[model samples]
Target: MSSSQQSKLIRVVQIIIDVIFGGLVFASGFLILWIIFTPLILKTSDISITASIPVAIGANDHPQLPVEVVGATGKGIRAAFVSDAQGTLQLETTTWSYIIISNIAKLLTALMLAYIFYLLRTVLRSIRAGSPFAPENAVRIRRLGYLVLLVSFLRPTVEYFAANEILNQLTITSPSILLPSPFKVEMILISLLILIVAQVWSYGLELERDQELTI
Candidate 1:
């Protein structure tokens, strides 16, 4: 494509990405507020818990949890709110640790996403300015890689403890609650790929600088 056409295309895509990013930030912020002020707004001290099943199942049928919620028995319970709850919404001080840890991870995730978005936008703008091999872009990409790797491990570790607390406290019969592993190889692979790209980008920047010096 022509230079002008490429710039326009990049601009359009950047705008679309920004819109999505904005929505994500807003939702993250709102949910965080809800989690914090849950006692006042919901008039109950209900600590929110979101649990997910493994993506792949064993040979046996999906373990069904005996729950009153619709599709929970068959489909299995994904998320359950734990509180001294039945007729009233109440928060237990004992479970406060779970809420705090979970929310800290949430806040980190939001910040990471915002940082990634900023780096991506800056890189795109550099490309539109015909400086795709700029040194700063390499640095940004490296930072992005590090950010992903850091969060991949850190968030999971934070969640492991939080989930452990819940499991130790409550006895979930149908579907058991388990602590998640801290090591995630997939995110490590992704971070390596990003770092590799950054290295290649840095090489290109060096070549560009050499060309300018020769001229």
Candidate 2:
């Protein structure tokens, strides 16, 4: 393709990506707000916890707990246990109020990702304008790389604590422990690569400035 055609194509693709990121940011922000204010908007009594925990059982024994019951303490207890010859157990819960704070951290990570995309879109704009090695573009790229690194470090810590908090609130006996190496190796590598590229771009910008001065 011709240079102009390539630039146009890149611009179109960047625009599409920008729109998608914008939509994601808006959706995440809306969810965060909804989660935060829903309890306040509705009556406390109206808010209820509905959980589903899957239990594996031996074929020889009947489940000790009934599917649904009201305890003597006046609280509703709902449980389901299925017999699995393979002996596998899975537990799932949908307690929005209890997990809202965790969701906020996750949503904030999404917002940070959206911001990275926004920075990338700005760099694309500079590239389309035939100034790919502009000093500002290099700075923007560095910022993007830093944000990615920050999220990589923060996300796992937040999630680990959140999972523990959820388990604690649900009165679960099992412990939720996250590994020490929570950040993905691939993400760390990618962030390092981006930072390297940003440095290279900065060097190219310096050369361009020197050339302009020499001319």
Candidate 3:
């Protein structure tokens, strides 16, 4: 293919990759919000406590749900409207809405990481094709990589605090017949690696641009 054709193809691929990655990131966030907030909404509709119970006592009573926020002083406590099987909304400070939210956040963060990897691969492919060094590309790629790394770093905190394996099935399941977690992660990494390669290619394109200008 002519250099121009090759460049066009690279741009097309980059656009496609961006669309897919953006979708995944958006979906992950949506799912996370749904998982975290749905239960609380249910609880709010269900429970109503008359007074604040000692957090320690309530936590022991309801181990499945934990409602403690940590801080420098000690454990921070807040009252929440919770619901149970009975159609009564009760106030409960010992309610564990955080667990639900944390589980979703963890899974969403993981998916975001995967998307970042995919974006990286697209960037690399573009670079390999001798694309011009557009600062926009570099800034975006860097921002995405940093964001993914930051999310991954926070994942452990979720595991440490709430540590619920709620969305493990949803997350672990293959979204497509051709894609599994291993494959997905692999593709994402490859995409990112390609993006890095693209940077070099972009340099060449700049040189080409300079040569063209001289001619």
How far is 24's C-alpha from truth in model 2 (Å)? 2.5
lDDT (Cα, 0-100) at 121 in candidate 2? 87
Q: Among all windows of ten consecutive residues in candidate 1, which has the lowest summed lDDT?
A: 51-60
Model 1 residue 160 CA deviation (Å) reads: 1.5
Candidate 2 displacement at residue 136 in angstroms:
0.9
lDDT of 1 by residue, 127-209 (tens): 87888998899999999899888878877776555555555666545333334445679998999899999999999999999
Every candidate's lDDT: 0.65, 0.65, 0.49
Query: How many residue pairs clash in each candidate at the backbone level?
Result: 1, 0, 23
Any runs in candidate 2 off by more than 4 Å, and if so which? 41-97, 173-181
* Candidate 3 residue-wise lDDT, 114-213, digit = tens: 5675856655565765553655556656667566545544554444333223222223232111111111354457556655755665575577679879
Candidate 1 vs candidate 3, TM-score winner: 1
Q: How big is the positional error of residue 157 in model 1, measured in Å on the Cα after superposition?
A: 1.7
Candidate 1, overall lDDT? Answer: 0.65
How far in Å is the alpha carbon of 107 misplaced in model 1?
2.3
Model 1 TM-score is 0.69
Model 1 clash pairs? 45-91
In candidate 3, residue 162 scores what lDDT? Answer: 33
The candidate that wins on TM-score is 2
What candidate 1 gets wrong by more than 4 Å, as runs, is 1-5, 42-98
Q: Can you list the residue pairs that collide in candidate 2?
A: none
